[model samples]
Target: MTTHKKIRKAVFPVAGLGTRFLPATKAIPKELLPIVDRPLIQYAVEEAREAGIEQMIFVTGRGKTAIVEHFDMAYELEATMSARGKDMSALDATRATPGDIITVRQQVPLGLGHAIWCARAIVGDEPFAILLPDEMMIGTPGCMAQMVEAYNAVGGNLISVLEVPREEVSSYGVIDPGATLENFGGALTEVRGLVEKPPVAEAPSNKIISGRYILQPEVMRTLENQEKGAGGEIQLTDAMARMIGTQPFHAVTFAGDRYDCGSKVGFVEATLALALAREDMGAEVRAMAERLLRA
Candidate 1:
């Protein structure tokens, strides 16, 4: 029997050149783009922290240094804010302890699997998580935290999934479910297999893989020999598919709203959705949205 080790580290694959956002992403990473006030990556980091993850391994690329600096203490800025009698509490969550964060560069633009493989040294031999910064999941207990609780009960490999429209299944990695679990708020499903970006007719099921993953370290080893799948680049889904029956793989259906911030429309929707949920801005934003819609 495989003894489940506690998941303490999470990998953030942020090496992608955000071609979708072009000029804006040319200088600033898409992960650092503000969803309202907080950057997209900050939400992922906070979710990981909430899930009992102690270490953060960022697989970064060129011009992504801003992400590193974002998590570090800005003494001068804090002092200035303090002198101005401004509240510094908002910045508290962004701070991290020294050495808690680790970064590795993926010099070549390989793929998602390759980006995660770059963090192999830091991940070592333990169960870890992979959170995509672009997938902004808004939930009460948090998505990753919910997955961590499920992982504690049944361990092996876990990935967050959502039921998408049948026609839209081709845009994601569709899952083949084995058995339905009775607990965890009825959001858990046993993963039988995974097909990456399959055609609508050939898709195994409507349940598509979302951004959050609690993967075993063994998948990294599998990725080392993984060949390119769909787009002539190493795909993470390909490696995970190989571990299907060998491990206790499951998919947790997320209970929150997910925003694919990788796309322009999705990013704007997430920003507005989050803004509308804030107590300070909800009513005003709602009224403004109604006026704009009416115009």
Candidate 2:
């Protein structure tokens, strides 16, 4: 029972209008927004790849063709790079080996659950993953990698979670703990229930769902007729909540930094943190930060 299931496919919901980002996002997808040198969606895809996911399914919208192309081969660009004998690392960031990707249009501004449902045909009967690109999780093993290990151990639905302050619980999907274990200097709790953005005073637990999830494909079927919840749009949390008691669900307390890059402030923070982590930019960032502090 401890054998790890090879979860080979992952669905990425990228259909949002990204209204939060305004005019800049008017043309460019917010998922294409760069954290440092890479787009937000690239970070999520890289995380899935690290977790052993072989196929990436992106649920996109009209303007999101760029997203599919971003992961696709740039033949002319590659030819130029090959001809120049250049490092080509820049081009490498945009290219995934052929046949590794699939893209479908969401066609409407629906909820997260709806976006996931759009990819149901390709996912089939296998257990799959859903990664929110806007939630950039940085770690040694990456967020999904850690969750995949936990999924192997638990053999059920798994959601990456982190303990947010009680006040912040209202801003996320909070988990109700049944039993807990400590590992890798972090806590893993057996989740009995989930409340989506519950009131601060009524939250069952302070642990909030971090973006990474290894969900049973049955959930996609459940979403087939799922009614709208929480803001009149299909809510993935609501669908996941219904799977309680039927499936073994747990909250994996991950060892990482979770950044909500969909917002203006969080995006800037990710940019600075990632830039400071890079060997090339670290020194410049340090000096400029110091100069800014002095000024």
Highest-TM-score candidate: 1
Every model's TM-score: 0.97, 0.95
Clashing pairs in 1: none
Candidate 1 is scored at a TM of: 0.97
Q: Backbone collision count in every prediction?
A: 0, 0
Stretches of candidate 2 off by over 4 Å are 2-4, 182-186
Instruction: Estimate, for each residue in 119-210, the C-alpha lDDT of model 1 and write its tens digit.
Output: 99999999999999998998978999999988998998999998998999988889998888886666889999998888999998999898
lDDT string for model 2 (131-167, tens) is: 9999999998998998888887777899989988898
Count backbone overlaps in model 1: 0
- Give the per-residue Cα lDDT of candidate 1 at 185: 63
Off by over 4 Å in 1: 1-3
